[model samples]
Target chain A: MPVIGGLHRTLKGKAALFILLLSVIGLGTLAAMFLRTQREMLAEFEAERMQIVEHFVVGTLKPVMLTGHADLMSGIMASLHSAPGVQSLAIVRTNGIEAFTDDATMKKVNDRLGENRFSRILKEPVQIVPAGDPMLKRAVESGKSDFVRRDVAGDGTVTSLMYPIANEEPCHACHGDDHKVRGVLVATFGLSASEAGTLQSMFWFSGIAFVLLLLTAALTYLFIVRIMAGRVSNIVDQVNRIVEEDRFDKRIVIDADDEVGQLAISFNHFISSVEIYRIEEGREKERLEQTVFERTRELREKNDFIESDLKLARRIQQNLMPEKFPTPPEADFHAAYLPCLHIGGDYYDVFEMPNRHVGVFMADASGHGSSAALLVSIVKAIVSTAGKDISSPSYVVQIINNTLAKLTPDDSFVTLFYGVINLANGKMSYSLAGHPPPMVYNRDSGELQYLQTNGSLVGVFDFDRFEDSEYIFQHGDRLLVFTDGLVEAMGEDGKMFGRERLAELFKDARYERPDAMTRHLLDSLASYTGGAALADDVTLLVVDYKKG
Target chain B: MKITMRVAGDVTILDMIGNMKSPADLEDFSGAVNAELDQNHLKLLLNFKDVGFVNSSGLGRLVLAAKKIGDKSGHLKVVNLAPDLDELFTFTRLKEKIGVFKAEDEALRSFQ
Candidate 1:
């Protein structure tokens, strides 16, 4: 959401527009009243001008009847001039031409018009412009003053009064008949005189109205801006501060029934509830972590106990292997045994044959641990009782496989390189079951040949067949037997010493004592792989086929 | 150190009364419940109404009881909490797993 910046004002509904509409309505009503008042005042001013015309014509004619002198025209002009709002006057006698008059310009206008001025200005009264005695025509006919509204001298709009004369007792002497109109007198007044008074009144009214309107606006603004908006904005500012500072713990304290007061109360309540929840959450989290810590400690102690017990059990289990192997009476025997770590399932043993042809066995479990060690122990026990029957290494493996097939888990199996050396003949036959082949170095040809016959690891299938390969050895022949671990030693740089490296190491090697050579070869391998952990068990067996 | 224990029907109601301030007592309480659960899987109600405060270690025992019951497929509910402990439950989202109620009847009826 976009933030509102200037003021923290939140007007929820339609209040602002409502106030604006009210102000315009108030001003419009006031203006209507002022215009109506001005129109009525103008109407009254026009009526007063008509009354002045009636009085001027009636008074002048009454006096002219008594004196019959030209002084009546000057007297009427002077009295009308002294009347308020009056500006000019012109009067003429009963002749067809200019008669007695008081306006100084009348003499000039009389010379200009001659006889036509009186008849033209008073006869029918031009409907368009100012003329003499529209009242004169009325007085001649109905004997009363008449009124007409016009503009004087083609300038501004105004009202004109025409008073006509038709009677005289003294007119019997040389003045002509009393029924013939004597003269017409004209009065001119500026309409702006009345307009000025009205304008002055409007000015006073407008001044007072403006002051009151301004005062009302100022009062409304004060109450709304200072009193109302002020209090509300104060609350809003506090709320804004709370939000900015993340001070949800603080609360607005209010004790009133109004909306803002209620809002303050509700806000306080919400803050308190959330604060309490936060504190509780802190406690709960601490508790859960403590529980986990305690559990970790328990598991550690339990693992330590279980590990020590396994060590003790491994020592007892190792004691069960055959303590000594008998030398074959008519054949030379050589053997090597290696276990990878603390314990493993690699075992080699020589048992005295009932027929005096010894059994030599070398067996490696598929993978080693306590379970495989237990299996090897079982194999040892079964083979100890089958001493006479285990003359051939292949027959021993076959019996072990059948016994272990039921004891092992599905898919578990072992491999063995087992053989029997017959002292009566110069030939020896060996069986290989999924184990690396033994190498025979023929002293005659000075070449090492590997005897490899593929077969499945035992304990997987009882129907699996073992392959036996034979070789006849001459004098000074050397046979080398080893587990796969011999070539798999890791070098100082973490590279494995593979079969090629081992074969290369054995090249052109000659030693007077086969035992010394065996010791020398194993020692050299150890030196080459210093500080590199062995990946598998290192096993070696060397036998010299001496001439009998 | 407060220990409040209630047995209603086959369900055991154990209220961690007062401030569970003593770690030894709390551990013992969790241990005892676990041994009892080992013998007979008793439904549990761990109430916190009178518990004023639980430091980190003391609260740990409650979690122990919860996990013990959870592992054995038995029910453990916490109920009738004072405000502060109630705060702890809500904060940890413990309210989601353990049925939290205001009173004993409410706690037991939750099983139904």
Candidate 2:
């Protein structure tokens, strides 16, 4: 899960990088140590070989010098010259001259032995040891062998040994025994190394280190990548599969008890929790759905019952209206009622009154629905009973108002225009109570007049007075009285059909029969409103007086 | 419709905006009136300058508000009625029960 330098690297990649880094550091350290150890061992081997050669030269030269085998000293020089690491060899006398170069001493020793073995003839060049050389002085004075090592140009190193031959009793047999030291043997050994050889060794060491590093890396890959990372990858694949398939029931397989195995176990525990949650969520969803379905069913049943009751109420309210208006030869009547709901607040009725008069009643109670229907029902009852006996329309309305004021609530009231028309004399007495003025159109003159009056709404104040306004009904005169809902019906544009439009429609339909005029007006209303549902109860009544 | 209430002297003025055509509008108008009356600030004046229309239901609610104020031994008045609503008040004879004034000061003075 760790990010390096804004890049997301997997666990295996980090492991491989870590192992490679360690291997590189280890390889470098091992190479340096191997190089240092190689150089040290070479130095030690060269020093040991130089010491052996020094001892060999001293031991071989002692017997030969004692036996007066001076020619054998040339053999010794030849042997030292033919040696592998030997550069040059010389025998220094007491006076720092080559011992064999003193021909007098050599002839004395050789004539005493009767041989030409001590011949003074020089076969090779002499190598002079530097006069002030520290090893030479030390070896000559102490009568011991000493060596000094120095780096020579281009040929590696040269080790020079000064071996002092002591003036012993045996060596004094030929020469005078006056001196403590006889001569020193100086030999230089070359520890030479070729560039090709160094390169070969270096190449071998590098190759071995490289092979060892490769082997370690291969094992690391096998263990980390193949075993550890492989299991982790398997766990990742399993998790991905579970997510893609949406199967929380499946789990990662546990292969070992290592870290990766523990990770798989943790993942499996998480999956189990998810699976349990999924099951519980499914059950909760089912329970919620079932509860909602049951509640909806119960609500629907209640709504259906209420709808049925409302339909029954509508039928009863419709029955309360005059199904057939009084068909007198003196006048013709037509009415249309459209409720905003199943029942309406607007009511109208046409029936015969006393003295050859026709009674016309239309009322709109305030507010709507069942409350308005109840108020309207009370008005209908009052009118059919008390109105039948009262000769004055104003007196009848006063009675209705007093009765309603006692029965209805303080906030509730009704607007009604009631009229009693004398079919015999064309005298119509009407009272407008908190209602919109109805239009009276003269079909003969084509003149329109609104029957306006100032009267308060019914049932609000029992002390309020009602007055009668009279309009003479003549031949070819039509009256259209309606509730406010007729004028206040809204169109799609939020404008009402309005009193102006209603009056215009009344004038236009002056020539039509009462029934046809009402239908035409309602059709125009439906058209103006785009046949949308009404927001209020609309009640329209048309009375045409066609006198014979 | 939204009703904004302000106090002018002893009278609580309710500024009725928008046409009181919907049932919600009726409730808002009645609620504002009832709330003022409940607080015993009963000398109320309804400012009807912005009211465009009032259907019968809205008229009923207004009547209910007036009756409520009247029953509380307080006065309710209206001012700045639109032309049509003034005519409505005239014919319906609501002007007889509640005072209709052309200006706020006239209605507020009538409260005394």
Candidate 3:
């Protein structure tokens, strides 16, 4: 079976069922009560009719029987029997013998008595017993004055009444007064035709009333369902459309001030909120996207400007390095430079000093980028002007340091190694200002030594000092100077290509020419670092003393 | 690089770690030192035990710190220098300008 609760699933169905049920109970009860009243009214009318007939018959017979006029009594009974709806009228003795009867009652007694002697004296006093009707017998035995009963026959209903004549003063003269009941008057009235017709009409009226009531109930149910279900269905349809189309702007159009209208109002409020939220969210997203686009454009423009400027600065820094070294006839100089950034802090220059000597200079400013590049330019200006004024390498360094210490910011300084090669005497003098010691490799002996100098960092303290160290150049000896970037180059495992490794490489590459030696050192560094990006600027300068 | 400062007697010990080679690193160090000086914490001990490297800019910052402290009529010292940094101090002759100590207690006692 399908679910039983679906009977009133729709509003129309529920309304119809409710109206039908209420009407059925109300009309059925009304009909039942009306029918019962009709039945009782008919019964009461029949009883009243029988009682009137009995009184009429008894009133007429009592006077006749008191006057001892049996013939008058018989004529009166015949007239009463001919009255409308009267089936039988008779007077019978207490022993159930008929005393007086109408012609119809006499005929019935004769037919029942069949050749009996009692049937011959129909006109005179006669003893005719209505034995077939036990009600009459019971009335006689009970000695009651009036009794009534009813029986249904094929043709009609019969109401029977038994009225007893009591023994009075006049009756005692005729009958010697031995019993209380002298005789009984019996009257039978037919009620079937009238009652049947009335009941049939009542039934037709009830049926018509019931049909009209049901029709009224059905129409009322339809009207209510149309008003309620129609409005509700409209709201549902609008809501479904809004949901299916994702249209928060739509609203229900119920105009009443009832519950459904209030519901529509609430739904519209919700939809309005949702629409506002959607609009706000869309605007917010657009605003965020616009902001991001603007920010990205600004960043891109700034980056482009910075990149162009850095490239220009890099070119200038590159120009500061010497492209060609002087031919000193005794030594060949070569240098390799790599900057971690677009601009580097490492700078090197080889210029001719007085007395036919060449000044080999390498300096590494702190940090990188434009600031360091600027610092290196200042150093270059100071060194170029001061180097000519000061013949000693240590004095040139001191002058540069004192100038930078006053000019540069406290958080920036330079480490430098400056050396002068006296080409005529084959002697080298150098000063180290807080820079890594330059290494000298003897190609013939395959031994590497560091040119240690007692000096402080430049551009840090005004009173700081620097000292010069001297080394005699020998044939087949190579001098290598580099910034800390060379020794501090880190591998993938975080180990530095330390000074020890550089010394080993310098000793091993002693047979290489100055240019080839610098190239070999860079290659080894690249191999050691596994081609990772350099974290600092690497600058290497190799000077090979070809002859002493 | 992280720089943390703590007080020992009258000395402010600034413990520095990580490489101090970049301009940004030096700026932070200088700013911290200046903040300490502004707070009248003149007696300072720069502890470089965990510091791995100090570039030219970092050395310059140390020198500047010493000079700033001296201008304020106070003393600045250094302690717990890493091997490389200790070598750098000797090469730069920074010990002559600023007292160099091998331990924090020694530096703190010097401040006392």
Candidate 4:
């Protein structure tokens, strides 16, 4: 299996082996036929020799036999037997005996001659063969000549012929016309040494020639296979080098215009395409990198510009709030503002109105960032100018609302809680415009209340109105007003720091000064939010009524 | 927020879902209102059964939508407010400008 497997390892090797097998079969058959034909010709030549000798014996002995010269016939047969390559010669009588061995047939033949010319029968006339020999019997019965080949101990090989002598009119007188065959001439001749040697030479020559032919075919096939293998190996080596070096530009050499050469050309074409694609891919990658670099630089520059502008806006917005609140003897004020972004919409202010009245203002414009910041600025301007003289909180709020409603978009609005606390009487009048109610905690009664009032969002409806809600302020009554951001700050569980929590904080911090109370509220809010960033602007304004 | 529109008689019912907090929610609610107003379907009912919280920004959008409908001489009303949102509406006096109904049928009947 391994030998056969080796033979068919490659296309060339398999093809060569196939051709070698065909040649061996063809030459082997040819040599076999040649030897067979030579053997048959040698056999026919030996048979022809026997028939000629048989004809000579019959022609010479028949006339001599008719003259009844038995001695003379014996001499002739003996001389023919002694000729070259003749092993034995004999004439057999029809009675299954040698012709001269039987006295009756001899006597009958002598009487027919009418002279006793064959009186003395030749003793042992060249023993023809056994009487029961099938060749001799068949020749006698069929009246025809037959031959057989036999290997003899002394002479290597010989052909034995049994020729039947016909009972013609002349032979009838001696045999009495009873048998159709008068006798059989039995002859055996050794094969000619020269002729055998020639045939053996021919056999050797055919065998050697066939071997040479097969050898030539095999060598030719091997030579072709070696040549093809070398070329293929060369191509393989070149391809390996190209792959190892990562050189797509190199092409395999096409030496011949055969299948192997075609493979080389195809590989070259593949390499060419790879080279082109690699080049294009490299160029595309470079182009993409360049584009990304440029875009990144441009975006970085724009981001820097926006960051700077936001910082400046934040500072301006911070400046808009009151630096210090009015310290009227009736109340101690504290406030904290934290923007969710660089700028915020939440605003708060504390200023002396008139005659010991403190004006307190807090507003949260809808939305946040730049747009909401702009809205709160407008609110500050209107409230500052309008509330300076007019003490009616609702009337001042109405003026601001009408101005903003005409000036801002329909979706733009502010929620504000503005109040005037007259320190002399400890009375406060405030308008709550869409704002969360402020918590008022009283120290004396230990009661917490919300100054809840209803007012639509400013700047949404042109005809929208706001009215004042009155609250009586007492000493130790602390008021906490805040934007929705403080209460709506979401905890990790998505729950809000709601109004109830703020109310609790405000009540808990009742004994603390307004500043300490505001700090506690913010700290609680920070705790509620788990220190996460606020999602909206937060503003806390704590005002404690200190009048006694 | 996801808003699906249906009709009960002449009133177009906008079933509001999710918190109307983000600016995108503002756009969605206002867009639904504008779409109804564009079709001249004056009677609008906003179903708030599935609504969660409405932030200040969200409140502003609601007012804007109401104002738009009012400017077009069409009525935009809301129903099925959660308790908190109902109090919110009361506190903000949004109920003064936009109708608040306890039920879809009652709101739809108001369009008559």
Top candidate on TM-score is 2
Q: How much is the lDDT of residue A544 in candidate 3?
A: 87
Cα lDDT of model 4 by residue, A48-95, tens digit: 776676677678777877654567777888788787767777788754
Recovered fraction of real interface contacts per model: 0.00, 0.67, 0.69, 0.71
Please provide, for model 3 over B1-112, each residue's C-alpha lDDT reduced to its tens digit, 9 standing for 90 to 100: 7899888767788988788877678778888898998899988888888888876667767787888899899998988887777767876677777899998887888886
Report the candidate with higher DockQ, 3 versus 4: 4
Residue clash pairs of candidate 4: none
Instruction: Please give the TM-score of chain B in predicted model 1.
Output: 0.84
* TM, every model: 0.47, 0.66, 0.62, 0.65
- Please tell me the interface RMSD, in Å, for model 4: 0.9
Better of 3 and 4 by TM-score: 4
Candidate 3 falls in which docking quality class? acceptable
Query: Clash number for model 4?
Result: 0
Lowest lDDT sum, 10 consecutive residues, model 3 chain A, at A1-10
Model 1, position A310, has a per-residue lDDT of: 55
| Model 3 ranges with Cα > 4 A deviation | A1-240, A243-246, A254-260, B21-31
lDDT-wise, the better of 1 and 2 is 2
Higher-lDDT candidate of 2 and 3: 2
Query: Each model's DockQ?
Result: 0.01, 0.56, 0.45, 0.57
TM-score of candidate 2 versus the correct structure, residues matched by position: 0.66
